[model samples]
Target: MALTSVAVVLPGRPTLFELGVVHEVFGIDRTDDGVPLIDFRLCAERPGVPVEISHGITVTPPYGLDAARGADLVVAPAYEYSDTPSEAVLEVFRQAHADGAWLLSVCSGAFALGEAGLLDGRCSTTHWRHSDELKRRFPRTRVDPGVLFVEDDRILTSAGTAAGIDACLHHVRCELGAAIATRIARRMVVPPQRDGGQRQFIDMPVPEIAGETLQPVLEWMREHLVEEQPVRVLASRAAMSERTFARRFAAETGTTPAKWLLAQRIHHARTLLEGTDLPVETVADRAGFGSAALLRHHFGARVGVAPGEYRRTFRSNERRAG
Candidate 1:
């Protein structure tokens, strides 16, 4: 659907960062760069009343909930997690969804959608810190904590803070086309699309391992990414039996040897695609993917874009920066 209007709902004590993300993507006028102008409205429970935001700041929204009645997109930014949104606010989300408008929630905003019953039986996500609570409160919603955003049907939910930018840009790309999305991202000085998911940002504390372990083997694997690394060969290098090596590798990395190897290879290919002007086949060979087709298969599955498309987007960003 063509996006012409966006309505952002402000609850009590809203987070300014996620609210800024919505404004940055939709509220900005970039018509000179070929982006369509969107009618952006910031609405609250009461019109012309000051609503308290984070850090002792207050914003007076000019429009009331009626502004969101038929907007093309309805957004709820992060708010206090413990506070229950008013029923009037929840009904706005429900009515907007029923009216076929795209529904989006950033960070703790998912709770409002959940209360509105829009997230029931839908795959949704929120900030990792609140993911467990979201799941506990709404048993029907499938909360994926690993992804930057989850788009199930027309309902979209995003993780914390910067991930809100990723989700908003994705919506812009889907509705307004990649060129417009790229322009907006360039204006914001952020990537049009980021690689990996929330899992990459989550802090994983290292478990203390007493003696000599797979650290050396992992280092060797990184150094020789282009070389074939079968489990048998890797086990021999670690001076352990295949069974022991496999167990130890999984324990240390939280993934099997083959899966870990594939991840490393894909990461290496991403680096080459971003930093170098190599042919796809050459990148495949350097990253141990064997062939261009194989690289495309693995890279698309992991990165959500083909190798050539990734290169073009990366190069476009670099040129914009230059």
Candidate 2:
């Protein structure tokens, strides 16, 4: 049996919430439900040295850099805005990478990982507020300010505070299975997963309350995706010209209305695929795709797998024939 161990490194002025996230996911006993349990430890470069946390709590780690180097996974939790980690922390992270351990950073901890040169030429994300600074500081790292988390092979970086939870849950789902990850999410009273990327968090201009905007029409479009209509019809419903509506819709939703509608149609098609025994052609028609070929093309492009394959792969365990 393979033993999974995760070492969470603590630097000065650590964000306690991020540390607690690591403990919640890895440090606790989770074997009651037959889920894989991890050997998780809190480590620091200078072992046994008292450290002050964000919420007036002080902590001391029994393990040091040696523990970090030996763990299967290394996690760096959040750091303060003004903090720059010591060379000791950076060197330990580099050595951990050299030893082939998976590296994860939550929120501002990506700064430390970047300093260690792991994120060079790699796509990464941080709290949206620091994306500019992270780009300026690490010119080699491609900073994506909009994603909740990015999984680039062995290195994963998450955005903002609560996004750490999403990234950790994603790891659980990837390493274990959706069933185990869903169980863990239920225990934590959080959603099992979120569809789409982090485009929802990207800043957008809110519609004026007194002015006519796309809000009502957008909700109506969502309700009537099965009614095949052209962009002109949608524009008419929103009381704007076709070109104006298209631009405004993109501004409001961070994507074009046509693309958004296609995404919603694909989402509905996936639900039908997972929940029903309907034929692919019928599912396509119901999702307003008009043909299975179109559905297959878009579905495969978006999901990286064909529809029938996805059905067989992700079919609910209870629904499977024994």
Candidate 3:
């Protein structure tokens, strides 16, 4: 269904960062780019009353829980985990899901959905720090702490702060089109999609980049994505030993050479699917997957959809616009 309206349910002591992320994705108007305007509403349990936020500031939502009754998408931003959400808020979630509206939660917001029983028997996730508690409290919900986000049965849950951006963009890409999603990402100055997962943040150390050491090599890699990039070849290009190059690459990119290359190939394949009518085999060959079967395998794993299905969804949107 097209996303025409969005309602954000703000619980007490809402985390400012997560609330900002939701507003940035849905509240901003970009009609000049042919993007559809979403009627975004921020609703609270008590309208016209100021609620304290995490950063010592207060916000007064203009609408109440009743405003979220029939929104196409309902968002729950992160709130204080110790506080129990009111039945009114939980009822909105239950009703939204029953009405077939897309439900999204960021960080501790997943707990509200869990309390409402909306996440029962569905795959979901939350911030890694609270994953165990969520699993213990809602045993019926499959909580994956490693992924940045998970979309199962129209319910979306994101792991932590920035991961919320990834989940929101993924929803836009699926519901609107990749072109519209990409335009939003450009305006926000963030990547359309992020690679790897929340696992990168579990215990990783800060990377140290001294100077313009890896810029040229990274640029070269992007230009030659379709070619074989063995560790030795890349090492030679960077004027370093294979072992040092591999170590430094992981330090800088937060992923191994093979994994990063595969992600880039998949991203290129998605662009081809959205913008061109190229055959799957041809797209696979051009994106360095070498064959249609290999492309479908990786594309399905990363995108949660087959290449042809993705093409049909985005190309149909293109036709409608034209």
Compose the digit string of candidate 2's lDDT tens values, residues 136-174: 999999989987788675888998887888888767654
Q: Between 1 and 2, whose TM-score is larger?
A: 2
CA displacement after TM-score superposition, residue 283 of candidate 3 (Å): 2.0
> Tens digits of per-residue lDDT for model 1 on 1-322?
5678999997666888889889999998888887778999999999999888856788889999999998989998999979898999999999999999999999999999999998999999998899999999999999998777888879989998988998998787656555667789999998676432424245565544455878789889989988889999998998888987876676666567877788778767866876788899999999998899999999998767999998877666545433
The candidate scoring highest on lDDT is 3
Residue 302's lDDT within candidate 1 is 77
**Which runs of model 2 end up more than 4 angstroms from their true locations?**
1-3, 200-322
Candidate with the greatest TM-score versus the true structure: 3
Task: Supply candidate 2's per-residue lDDT for 227.
Answer: 89
Candidate 3 TM-score, C-alpha based: 0.89
In candidate 3, which residue ranges exceed 4 Å CA deviation? 196-198, 207-219, 235-254, 318-322
Stronger candidate by TM-score (2 vs 3): 3
| Candidate 2, residue 161: how far the Cα is off, in Å | 0.8
State TM-scores per candidate: 0.67, 0.69, 0.89
